[model samples]
Target: MKNVNYINESKEVFDVIVIGSGITGGWAAKEFCEKGFKTLMVERGRVVEHRKDYIAEGKGPWDFPNRTKVDNLLVEEQYKIQKQCYAFHDGTKHFFGNDRDLPYNTKKGTEFSWIRANQLGGKSLLWHRQSYRLSDFDFAANKADGHGNDWPIRYKDLAPWYDYVEKFVGISGNYDNLPQLPNSQFLPPFEMNAPERAFSQQMASDFPDKPVIISRCAHLTEPQKIHVELGRMKCMARNECQKGCSFGAYFSTQSTTLPAAARTGNLHIAPNSVVESLIYDEATNRLKGVRVIDNDNLSQREYFGKLVFLCASTIGSTQILLNSKTNKFKNGLANSSGVLGKYLMDHNYNARTTADIDGFEDEYYIGRRPASLYVPNFHYEPTRYHKNFIRGYALAGGAYREDWQSYGYTDGLGINFKEKLMHPGQWKIGLQAQGEMLANRDNQMTLHATKKDKWGIPQIQFDVSWSDNEKRMMESSVEVASKMFEKAGFKNIQGQATERPPGIAIHEVGTARMGRDAKDSVLNGYNQSHDIPNLFVTDGASFASSAVVNPSLTFMALTARAVDYAVKEVKNRRL
Candidate 1:
């Protein structure tokens, strides 16, 4: 960090301006700067430095003011929407946004949970770290089913980029050669405990079509030279990642991409600068810059750039595009297709089933494991097709023994209860569904007619909801998980659909999708705006469909590839 530059105001026109310093924004900045292009990375929140800023790291539940539970009053007033997140707790509450300050409305009967991490690292600091690569099945799902427009690019277009990013990011997993869920460049995978191994073996014997494997994640199971040089270490399995990882064990903007970007002298960052909208120059038919409002104060400023990449989260990027209206494209900037704010999609993560495993009592595992056991989608395979739903889902679960913490308000007392609590209880297995969501034009988000935020930006209102396809998928998931458990000889299998809102998965994607034609999509194959060449969106907003897996790794690969293409286009003087 010799010449690391952080500024609030800048008038110099940069070669690239990246909006939002989360996962993709960090990669965009790193790619451009390393290519010798002067880049400006803009973040709409306060700076969160890597090791020095993890205030809650290395601390246990006892250190927190409320024993790892966020205060009820604070949650009610400030974290109404964010509280719904699985990672939202007192230990990591600082990473979540104050929902009262970030207000938006849902349509009459629909509900949305727009989980936000408003800081320099964005949600990268708070992500669950499950990294997965979508296959041709996902890319071609929309075209085959006619749910949405066809994706202009396919898996081959992104496989090399996935290898590039995965090696640098240090993904840990086994090479499960499933076509629907492809393998990634990986480190040594974490080991499954005795119970989980038994569970996997039984599932293999019973349901051989659906292979059960260890989940892939961005943990440093074995640090490579690239990761070691970046000051990251093997995962210690603290499992408190939302509070931040000081060892850089998990991939986050603060740990990996930001440091790499800052190592180059050409990188400049503007924190606390909330972009109001993109500055589209009608004369050049290009995105010239952006207009932003300071997060703390109400002062306004402008940033000039030759090219701009919107790496803001799916909703945030779409909000900016929807607000950036011009004379030529009044609907939104680069929204010539009239699909800027339509075709919104999110993963259906609602169905859950838990069962008790009666054996493996003598083998008690000690520490927490970073990843879960995953069962990939098998409905697309021959003889395994479904009737009600078109797309499929993946199941994530693990086998765990009940500890003292698992018992709550027990009615036992004295010596009998104390002796019983000393030993680990029966091995329990829990499975959660991560189903694909169909891209529907009816599930949309639009700018409010009159509502505005504190910074005078139009508030976004979401009308997105689970369609019949998603509901049927979740319902099928419950039955499928219970049947799998029964086949594995697990007892007490209870399965039910938890009808959660659309955005609760926090994997909300699309709303500005990439497609083959200009009339049906917002971006092209290169993630460049169909109507504006100099503008690109490499975030989840550019996804055409919600693939049935974690989408962060795809986001990383696309951003790196987009930057490479954007630079070549610039050298050709195309912009």
Candidate 2:
């Protein structure tokens, strides 16, 4: 809620500058501020205060003029790309960026939906909140398949950081002891309804390799002293989280990290300051500062910092790096490896299946449970290799009886329909597959040559597509899901093997990957730029591959770990 205008303050160099205010940015700011560094967090969007700025929170469907639906005219004009996302609606549309304002081009035959949320909290306030830890299977995946750069740091290096982040964020889930999906330091898991329990039992019996459990989420199931000190409480199970949780029940930059960072007093937030590029000092062989563009006034300014952390989203960070060109680095800053905008990846999650349960009419859930059921990747082990595909996919779903609202689609007379509406319908179950997308060099994003945005930054152009492996994996997902539904004795089973174009999953990663060799990658194991020692990129841009899981948790772990390394290197004068 505290906005600091750096332009009015003395032009003194800060200890650290974090160029983003999203998930990783928030973490970086908190870590840096708590370490007693004078940290400045530069956010391109408007400041959104926790609880106070959630304009749509707690609003019911009937509260809106058009119910929960966004106007068709607005969608056609400003939200053509954003509307493709599943979360975009009347209540949450304010969080999404307008496609018309943030225009980008795609290849002739391929399409990449660049979903963006530019606000104080960024996508952290709008994410699905599903948090899962990546395993050695993901770390060793690139080496095993020779797809992308081999991850320099394995699961062991990140496990402790994951625990640290999970403890602070208050993840809620049970420990299943699955190697593929490591357990987090969690609060108690939410209870499942009768239908979900039955589905889990059937899945365990029929598909022993695939274990169904409660999906891990960043919700305060049981608020601890740390949470209470931050003015947060336990989740109320309202499930209208995308609108923002006024109760601070969910894990978001506004709800958690922003407040923690603010409490440190070393934190300084500069909102509406869009980063144009980094300022490189050839003499010092380091980044001197950052060039910032005022989002509204179109005026330019520069802020100096000893260390720079690029916590912007994958594409956002890449764009800033590519624009920060110097005489020594003709192509881009820290892009001597020529792999900056290549190896782009996203999760393939279009394939899905649904079925109707015969019974459970009497059963009903009390409140809106935010988390879903999760089935870990069964084909993650080396022994369980797919002939058609190299990687695996995870399944997220749940079973619930249809409520009275579902009666709108049923055929009935007035009296009969009124009577039937009193009773809930049969339980229905669904499973959506989230397959790992291989890191492909051709699936790239670059800046448009001729086009520039309002702030004089080049428009991003995307050329990404799904390969045969992804298509085959999607087919397998539908087939396996249908088989599971059939084995579970469900009726009217339906499945889909289709895959949406890249970026629909909102899990876009890679572009500036990490590896041991600087020739093939942009960053090192510590997320430090191979070319610029004092610069760090701790967001998804440093991912070597897009593992089959929601990536926010992994991003947080990587950011925390990178912060520790950066701080140590700075103190030791190694950077």
Candidate 3:
């Protein structure tokens, strides 16, 4: 790689330029800078410092303006898409994108919720920290069913990188020797409450294949030397993680990657810089730099780099690429495979079941646990019989006693109801089903030719939808959840489908997928673009299939592995 230090009077350049400073971007910045590249990370919003920015972390319910009630007018005016997420409340509203400021179009008869945070840390600050690895089942699913394209790599390729990330990020979970959802290097799994423990035991006894393990999360249950060195503490067990953890208890860009990258003295961050397009050099057939528009002023600027990592979220990154049309690749930048915005997917999560547990009246646990109990996927085992669907879904649920807030349904006058609510009510069990959404080309995203955004870039129009296969899987998910509740001896069982909408799972994946051949795949095994070897995309965009498990951990592993490969390639002058 050339190390030219030329500062154009108008344009700026760096060794490596990363777009979007969320989880993937943070990792890219950290990796590039640590690997001796002067990195520039551009965030479309303002800077949010670690501890200081978490304003609502220590606040109580009374401290909120509406006493935890979300402002209805604000929801109507600002966060129409963001409100769909349960975490969008008064305390954490500042962390989400205001709909008025960053608006995108959706097709008629289709509802697309693009929940986003353009701030320095991005959605990483407010993400549900549940972490899990996608196994060969996910990578081989495409090949097995002929749905999309086979994954370029398998679980073995990412396992070591998973270890590398888990060791530093501090995941807490039991080592459940499950092949489908592999266990991570954990700190210590949080203990479940009495009712949850009872449910776990019942599930284990009734269905041996489906074990209920504590939610594997990136939150530090017990911080080690590495975490302490990074100025992070163990999780205080406060469930108020979406408000941003002031303790640095959870894994966010502010807590982990950004600080590590900044420590290298090679990181340069340009906040309020919205990356509009990639400057593709047609003669060289490589990405030379990026064209960015100032988020505040709309002023344009260009930044050069030896390499670029498009870590913008699944949809956002693809939008940038699709907009960067050049003569060499008229479809999009590095879109030679014609799969730039194809196979767009998010986990099907509308199938859910909730119930009230009758027992465990005297049992109560202290501290707000950040993790839930996870029942791993039980469908499609070699001997197990699953008639309806090829793929499966997992269950994440837990038991929580009714707090002082449960009195909203009661009509008891005043003091009596208040006292009753304070002590806790019957154990409530709520389970959400996360079913795998197949990678179908018909479920895709395209740039609207006529609809342009404020920056003159075309608005992304999604044509994504679930197939009969996904619907079948979802039906099975509801059945499994209902049965699990019944087997656990829970009453008042209610199962309902919330209906699938685009991007609701926050696990949006597979715009530019990995595959065996350059003609068919946008990225190879190392996340290096098949058409442009110098550029890599290690985000959810490279996912071949949406596995039942969460995609963040897989992205982390892929990123770490890709960074190692990129470093080695740089050392060998292979670019």
Task: Report lDDT (CA) for all predictions.
Answer: 0.90, 0.90, 0.83
Candidates 1 and 3 compared: the better one by TM-score is 1
Stretches off by above 4 angstroms in model 1 are 381-384
TM-score of each: 0.98, 0.98, 0.96
Ten-residue region with minimum lDDT total, candidate 2: 1-10
Each prediction's number of clashing residue pairs: 0, 0, 0
Candidate 3: which stretches are off by over 4 Å? Answer: 1-12, 380-385
Q: What's the lDDT for residue 201 in model 2?
A: 90
Q: Give the TM-score (vs. native) of candidate 2.
A: 0.98
What is candidate 1's lDDT per residue for 58-112, written digit by digit as tens?
Answer: 8987888878888899889999999899999887889988899999999999899
Query: What is candidate 3's local distance difference test score?
Result: 0.83
Kindly list the per-residue Cα lDDT of model 2 for residues 148-198, writing each as its tens digit: 779999999999999999989999999899989998998999998998898
